[model samples]
Target: MVKVEFAAALQRHVPCAPQSVAPGTLRAVLEAALAAAPGLAHYVFDDQGAVRKHVAVFVNQQQVRDRVRLDRPLADGDSVFVVQALSGG
Candidate 1:
């Protein structure tokens, strides 16, 4: 199973916990995790189902490059971290 964790900053708004989801593409893993806290989907994804511009997702410490497709493959035991990106001066 893939281990998915939301950053503390993000959790403050939606209150989600780290969870293990079936190994699959990034989209699948996110869907499983969000199932527990459906409201969180709004913070992570935009209206078109693409990752929000202010959100970032990392797999095994590497940042994912495809925000729109979210096709990055995840394997069992892989660690996925979702965080709200900081911006502004």
Candidate 2:
């Protein structure tokens, strides 16, 4: 199983807990994890189903490059971290 965790900053708004999901693409893993947390999807994805500009996803501590498709594949034992991206000068 792939481990998915949401940052504390984001959890304050939606209260999602870290969970284990079936190994798959980033989108598939997230879909499975977020399915248990109502309203959390709106904060992570936009109307087009792309990751929101303010969100960031990392796999095994490396940042994901494809936010639009979120097709990065995950294997068993991989760790996925989702956080709110910080911006501004």
Candidate 3:
């Protein structure tokens, strides 16, 4: 199973949640996560449903490219971490 971790900013949406999910592509993972916490969809993706610029997705410790192609395939035991980028100046 692939693990999905929500950053502190996202924890409010999912309380006491597991950090893993069934093995699948990024799309599948996000879909399932959204299914469980529909409210997160709007915060993570844009109106067009694309991952927002400030959102980052890491698979197995490798950062995923910012594109719809996050559909990148995943295997069992992999991990997917979803975090919101923070910026201040």
Candidate 4:
């Protein structure tokens, strides 16, 4: 199973706990998560269905490069973390 977690910043907007999901692309897994926390989708993606600029996604401790596509494949037991990135000084 793939584990997905939302940072404290996102938890404030939608009360969700870390979840375990079937292995798939980052997009597919996050889409599943959106179903569980319907209200959290908007905070993670933009109107264009892309990850928001202020958000960061990490798969097994490696940061993802494609914020728009999120096609990065996931493996069983991989840990996915979505966090709000810090900006400004």
Scored by CA lDDT, what does every candidate get?
0.91, 0.92, 0.75, 0.89
Better candidate by lDDT, 2 or 3: 2
| Local accuracy of candidate 4 as per-residue lDDT tens digits, 1-89 | 99999999999879888888898999999988778898999999999999999999988888787899888788898999999888875
Q: List the residue pairs that clash in candidate 4.
A: none
Worst 10 residues of 1 by lDDT: 80-89
Tens-place lDDT digits, model 3, residues 28-52: 8877766767777787788887888
Error of 4 at 36 (Å): 1.1
Candidate 3 segments exceeding 4 Å error: 13-16
Clashing pairs in 3: 2-21, 3-20, 4-19
Q: Tell me how far the alpha carbon of residue 31 in candidate 2 is from the true structure, in angstroms, after superposition.
A: 0.5
Instruction: Supply the global lDDT for candidate 1.
Output: 0.91
Worst lDDT run of 10 residues, candidate 4, spans 63-72
Better of 1 and 3 by TM-score: 1
Give per-residue lDDT, candidate 1, residue 86. Answer: 75
User: Candidate 1's residue-wise lDDT over 1-89, tens digit each?
Assistant: 99999999888998988989999999999999999999999989999999998888999998886899988788998999998777874
Q: What TM-score does each of the candidates earn? A: 0.95, 0.95, 0.84, 0.95
User: Cα deviation in Å at residue 53, candidate 3?
Assistant: 0.3
Instruction: List model 2 lDDT by residue over 35-85, tens digit each.
Output: 989689999999999999889999999988688988888999999999988
Score candidate 4 by lDDT.
0.89
| Residue 72 miss distance in model 4 (angstroms) | 1.4
